[model samples]
Target chain A: MGLRRIDVCGLPPPEPLERVVEALTTLESDDALVVVIHREPVLLYSLLARHRFHWETTLRDDGVFEVRIERRP
Target chain B: MTPGPGLSLTQAPPLSVPFRFYLGAPLFALLAALLLVVQGPDALASRWMPEALAVTHLFALGFVTQVMVGSLMQMLPVVAGAPVPRPQLVAALVHVPLALGALLLPTFFLTHWPWTLYAAIGTLGFSLAVFLFAITTSLLRASAGFPTVGGMWLATVSLGFAAGLGLLLAPMHAGLVSVVVGVRHLHPVWGLAGWVGLLVVGVSFQVVPMFQLTPPYPRVVLRFFVPVLFATLIVGSLLDTSPMEPYVWSLLGGEFFAFAALTTYLQQRRRRKTRDPSLGFWRTALLSLAVCSLLGVFRPFVGLGNTARVDTALVILFLMGFAGSLNLGMLLKIVPFLCWFHLQATFLGRGPVPHMGMFLGDRAGRRLLRVHQTALFLLAVSLLWAPAHRLAWSAVAVDAVWLGTLLVLATLRYRRAVRALAAAST
Candidate 1:
């Protein structure tokens, strides 16, 4: 089954930390999901850890990073 | 007031507006509101049971104060033309006692514990310190022209008086004083009308026009509201009711003028073609304010038993209907805008990342507005005949569901926006 698509545009400067965790928890996808983020993924990784969202990040450029997560169905 | 050094508009904005930290407070306040919704009707039905104090404090300190402090922090900058000193520290310091005190105060009141009283004293002192700092900073940076800022000045003064009175009344239940000094009586007035009411009125002056795309309320009305209400509250406290009637009348008249201004503004709104949840909220707030004005006239006739019910209704109308709806409506506009604003700040003119509207789907928000409307409608009905405790609780449950839905939608939109920015960067 294809994963549900969602966007994370226009969040305030504080970044949507509580939100990223919430999305990961609710999405519940076994299929690989692609998440793109601006800037470095360091802050986002820590936030994910704080909220207990296990995932992997791959840096493609200074302003672009990709996160992939797979949920057990 | 002296236009002190560093008087530039860009440098010296009001300190009352702490947009970010204050935003966090509402989440906790909403949790507290949920608890009160579960507990309120049952406690009320029991007819002044000992537990009523606990429930009242839950809403008062937990929900109301939470929102109030956060809002103060956020608005101080906008209203006073100055930012608060060490805002992060202030938030951390206040949050501990405020949250803990709300929980402990009720338990102490019910059990009559001395330690809890000591704890209460500590918390109140901490809050007093915070407010004093906020007030001082606000006065130092305040500029001319904003009536809302003037209202805030009055609110700060009233808070000091209210806090002092509250401290005195703490000894009443312990029989330290001969007569029951009526400090607790002023608690609601200071809290409800003085602080929250004044601030909301002040904000509505700015928000209503901007959001609805209407003209500002008349300058005369704006100038009169603060002075008239402050005089009424002060004179009424010092003198007997006979002399204070005119001031009270003035206060009510001010509120009516505000309501009328809102109605007039709504009539001329550029967005008149829409039936959004925000519009539903506007109607609810206007209607509630009108009812509250009528209640003010009948307040003298209300007996002790009827007074509690009537007062509770008024509180529900003002706090939930007026403050609550305004909060929801503003969030609808703010959250999405913030999301988009942050994402696009760096790329101002370079690329084609959409405006704030592009980040938040207005159509999707419009659909969610229906859910909010439904929840609010059920909430109003539940308040009227809160027959069983569970019924009120269920209303809260529905409201939580609505909140959850909004949270989900906000997150999805936020993620999509980030991805879009990332794609453009690459």
Candidate 2:
């Protein structure tokens, strides 16, 4: 599956966390998800680890956070 | 790279520490409401009345301060990355005595009893000292440099001063230090502004954006606001019954305007589309601040003939409208959220955790909110027109019971869910 991008910027905390969760659940083995948020979702990293998924976070120049996720192979 | 184990869910104090205080607050509020019912408009007469003194200490020390202290204990570890040492010891020492002092100090004021006054001075003074030292040291060790930390720091300072001043003033009733002991304005001002207002504003910096999906508060305000407010409070306290009263008013006027303006702007920018009771409560508080600050600043110019009436209006607006509404609003959010957090963390892999919303449930929370709103409206009206006084007192009594019940039920629901999970696991 192609990558899915979920925008959680400007949304409050649990919303960003929830939107990323929903997006992650919808992705297939080969699919990937990208989350755009205002702050680093430090807790999300642990959550992904719990689900045995992998994520890489990159800080954009604009100060927004972008987290990429996919199932671990 | 492997995902790092950043912090455990257990980083915050065991839910019991905060929960004990949270559960205790409504009980105190209930006591205050019952006291109101007993005294009626007589207590509402003026700031100088014994009834007024009793009610103020009950609400300030017993309810609002308890919640603030409890929340700080919870947040210091999790939010600020500093955990108070020997938290259970801290709780026992702080909570029990505070509750005792709330009852005794107010009794002393109402009854003019020397024993009660002395007991209040002893209990409240000791509890507050322990609270300040434990909290401040823990904060000093805190690694995180969040704005909330600064607020807490100054709040502790304010609390120390307020408590000291309170202890000093206690003797006046006992005929110990005899001269009018006019630091009365300074005492409550520091108590309300330094302790209550600072903590509220400080916690808002973190909570408002996260819980409500609002933008971060301005950096300048976060960095400079609390310190300046603390300074002004100290100066005002020292200038008690002085000619510099006008300058003090100016100092406070500027501060309130800035706070109200920032709070209003940030609230308006909140991303939520639907209505929220917390927001309604906050709006009530902010409006009270805005209107009252204006009135306060120009009181010298505009002759509001009845000092007692004006003082009563300001107290209700500040204590009930601002502090009380904000206290309830935050408690509603924090209680359910803490339940959800603890449950989810506990049962992450073991079993199905209960739905977070099921703890308080939306309908119940909304109903509770309605009760508070109605009570607040009646109380505000009672101040304007004397006839509504009994109605206001009765409504507040109901409101207190209503809030306590909702919170207790929420806690029960949380415990039940956890028990069910354990049953399924085994």
Index of the highest-lDDT prediction: 2
DockQ, 0 to 1 scale, candidate 1: 0.02
* Model 1 RMSD, rounded to 1 decimal: 12.7
Clashing pairs in 2: A12-B213
Error of 1 at B79 (Å): 5.1
Candidate 1 residue lDDT tens string, B322-382 = 6666665655665565455444433333345455555445675666556555555665676
Can you tell me which runs of candidate 1 are displaced by over 4 Å?
Answer: A1-73, B1-42, B45-50, B76-80, B109-113, B173-181, B240-276, B301-305, B345-389, B404-426
Q: Give the TM-score of candidate 2.
A: 0.87
Top model number, TM-score: 2
Per-model TM-score versus the true fold: 0.69, 0.87
Scanning candidate 2 chain B in windows of ten residues, the lowest lDDT window is B1-10
In model 1 chain A, where is the ten-residue run with the lowest total lDDT? A9-18
Off by over 4 Å in 2: A1-10, A16-73, B1-10
- Individual DockQ of the candidates? 0.02, 0.22
Pick the DockQ winner. Answer: 2
